[model samples]
Target: MGVVSVKKSVVLLSLGHACVDVYQGAVAALVPFFIAERAYSHAAVAGVVLAASLLSSVAQPLFGAVTDRRALPWLLPVSTIVGGVGIALSGVSGSYAVTLAFVAVSGIGVAAYHPESARVARIASRGSHTAMSWFSLGGNVGFALAPLLVTAVVATGGLRFTPLLVLPALAGSVLCLPVLRGLAASAANGSVAAQAKRPDDRGSFVKLSIAVVGRSITFVGLSTFIAVYAQERVGGGVLAGTIALFTLYVGGAVGTILGGRLANRWDRVTVVRYAYLVAVVAVAGVVFVPGPAFYLFVAATSAGLYVPFSLQVTLGQDYLPSRVGTASGITLGLTITIGGLASPLIGGLADATSLRVALAPLIAMPVLSWLMFRTLPEPAVMGADGSDGRQPAPDVGHRGAVAVGVDAPGQVGDGDARQRS
Candidate 1:
């Protein structure tokens, strides 16, 4: 494939990624509407969020494991449609049980879409951190847009108009066609080579996963309640909440791009560790700061948490070269969604006490993340051809040695290499 074609494929994949994640963001965006329309308690609405994540979390790793053994590009479009359909139907019925079920169905679609999409994105990106960041930025944009989209559609027409929410999914599914065709053409031409097998670094990946879980809990916790919390802090009603949520998510777009640039200069582990340190301070500010200043802190927290977002996905893949699918699934899917598991607990606490108090505990999550990252070693960088590449000089303050590189077993020319310093 030519450079133009590769860039086009990556762009389309990123758009498709945006479409699918709209539903993921929409789930949170819909929380306020659910409360207003149904008079559901904090815990009750949190259960709805739980439904969206519970099934997805369990199914993501399974899907990744399956894709590890077989490439399922078709899942991209199919899952996109399924995810949209579930969310589209979620608010149509008033039955709480039915809503939960539909949301769970959406979760399944989301779970199915991520592992394969990550694989495709990695291939299309050719192992460039900037390219992968753009792919991740698409999802962040989707998340940022969800509030505005949901508020526009459902706020004016109420939850019954949720069918309109399916538009992005349909659009996303169509977007997948050209990219899939391009991939097929590349495969037919044998431009895609088989990956050389390498050993998996299970220990580093475990530590990385734990750090991701911490970040996840912090991010998901904030995303779930930041809107409502904003209202409590500022008094602009729904508009205040929407703006806050947007600020939080939009900051992530900035962070993803910034992370890519930073990774090009420093090893990913160092970048991630420092980002978490920033997060620890930023999260505290978000919790205690008053008035519109709260928005600034929210943005800081989002940016700090997200600066390592794409880097972590690539790091997980590098740490487990032999299980890219599983790594992608865990980094991009399982561990990320696992944060949702805490939503109910947060909601229950909010119900028993207050949103502020419930969220206060989140301040420590990034601290734990920083601690985990402190112990992680940077994996060996791979070349564009899937061979071990020259190691860059160690970054200042980096403690762990860069591990020796190995050619992992997989399709070669998939762009699994880090940028050369």
Candidate 2:
């Protein structure tokens, strides 16, 4: 494959990623509307979030394991449509039970889409960090746009207009075709053979996953209620919540891109640690600070939390080089969605106490993440042929490489690595 083809494939994959993730964002974006239209309590709406998350969390790793065994590029488009359909039908029915069922179905679609998509992205990106960051950015952009998309269709026509939400999924599925074809062509040419298996560092991966769970709880909790919280703090009604959600998501785009560039200079673990430290303060500001400046803190919290997003995915892949699909599943899908499981707890607490009091515990999540990251050593870089790239040293533990750089042996330079059969 040529550089142009690689860039094109990555771009298409990113756009498709955005389309599917729009529903993920839409789930949270729809919360305020669900409250206003249905008169649902905070706990009730949080259950809706659980419906979307609970099944996805369980199924993502299973999907990843499947992808690890064999490629399933077709899942990309099929899952996209399924996810969109589930979300589109969610609001059309008035029954809460039916709504939960549809959302869970959507969660399954999301679960199936991620592992295979992440594998395909790795193939397309040829292991470039910057490229992967761009791919992650697409999902963040989708999240940023979800509020506007939901407000435009559902708010205007109420939940009945949700059918229109499927349009992006349709468009996204179409966008996936060219990339799928590219993968097929590569496979036919024997350039897309099974990657050489490497030793799995289960220990480091476990620690990284724990840190991700902490990050997930913070992000999902904020996304779930930031809009409502914004309304309470700023008195701008739905518009305030929309803006707050938008800021929270859009800032992630900046953070992801920044993370890629920073990785070129600092170790991924180091970058993640500092970012979490910043997140601790920013999340506090969002929960406690008042007035319109709340938007600024929301953006800060987003950037801080997201700087580790793509880096963590790549780190997970490196840590478990032989199980890239499983790594991607956990880093990109399972741990992230698991945060939604806590939404009900937060909601129930809010119902029992004030929203402010309910949100106070979230301030410690990033602190825990920072602590976990402190224990992690970066894994050895895997060569193109699946060989470990680290040179033996007395100080380097059994975990392998303690740091990575653009010029590191076996590392692919930005936009330069391409598969050759």
Candidate 3:
């Protein structure tokens, strides 16, 4: 098959990713509205956030495990629609408990889509990091667009207009049908067969999860508090905060693109380690540096932190090839969410001490993440025929050259020989 064909398939999966994550992004954007329209207390608002994070995190791995045992292509469309509908209903209820339930519904939908979609992306990608990056980029774009989308509709039509948010989910699911069919076709061709022969590495996956946890804490912390930090320092109202948040998100999107290229050039583990190293310094600059100069470091910190995002997902799948769905769930869903669990502690610290003190701890997380990457070994590349699970011969070509396995291309059991070449 042509490279163009493979890329088009990956793009479809990326679109589904974007559609699913839009709800997650909207949840964060919805917080202020809840406080203003419903007069929710800070604790109540925290509860709402917790509802979304907890269900999504806990259910994702379960969904992954289910997909590993059986393909759930239908889940792609179902989950997208469910996620959007849940968010749409959130504003209809004035009761705090009712609102929490609606948010949790959205979280569950978010959880269901990630693992299966990621697994499809992996199979269709044939082991190309650049291709997978496009998938990750879609989710990032959805997240970045959330505030604007939610704010625009709500600002014009009031909080009651929240139902309008569901349109994306509806449209996304309709558009995603063809993508799901493509995934099914890819699996039938040989992706599913390749998986049965591959072994799962539980130990490495656990370590990678830890590394993901560290990165998540720093990232979530920045997203949660950067706007506030900017408002205090920059002396502008919501606009200044919005600008700072935009810088971080846009930086992440750009970093994701660069990470794919860097991984292709220098190898995945090396790129992950160095990115975290840069993250440490950048985060410190964000904390200590004064005035608008700090915004530069915020962008720098976002870039460094996000460079490892998609790489980690692929690494986890490589580490546990037999359970790509489960690995996707853990890496893409569960591990990163562990950061949300720590938000209350950080908030308490901010209450007791200061925002600077709360943020100061994030600088150390990247250092720990860097240390974790040092222990990871390069994963074995799949043979052109993904059926046989064996490492390729060493130094088959020039420096940075990938060694092709002793299997014919486009055969069952040969995943995508494209990576080895």
Report the lDDT tens digits of candidate 2 across residue range 1-421. Answer: 4323988988998999999999999999999999999988999999999999999998998887666655567899999999999999999999999999999999999899988787677667777778889998998998889999999999889999998999999999999888777655544443222334357789999999989999999999889998899999998899999999999999999999999889877778899999999999999999999997888899999999999998998888777765667788888874558789999999999999978888889999999999999999977674655566532111111122111111132222122232210
TM-score of 3: 0.86
What would the per-residue lDDT of candidate 1 be over residues 1-421, giving only the tens digit for each residue?
4323768877898899899999999988999999999998899888998999898988988887766656677999999999999999999999999999999999999999998788777766767788889999999998889999999999999999999999999999999888776655555443323333456799999999999999988988888888899999887999999998888888999999999889888888899899999999999998889897898899999899999999998888777765667778888774458778999999999999999999999999999999999999888864545457533211100011111011222333222221110
Of 2 and 3, the candidate ahead on TM-score is 2
In candidate 3, stretches whose alpha carbon ends up further than 4 angstroms from where it belongs are 1-4, 35-43, 185-198, 385-421
TM-score per candidate: 0.92, 0.91, 0.86
The per-residue C-alpha lDDT of model 1 at residue 281 equals: 93
The digit string of per-residue lDDT tens for model 3 on 230-344 reads 7777768656766777777778789898998888887788899999999999999988897889889989998998899898988887776655667788888754466666766
Whose TM-score is greatest here?
1
For candidate 2, the 10 contiguous residues with the lowest summed lDDT are: 392-401
Q: After best superposition, candidate 2 residue 261: deviation in angstroms? A: 0.9
Clashes of 1: 12
After superposition on all CA atoms, how large is the RMSD of candidate 1? Answer: 5.5
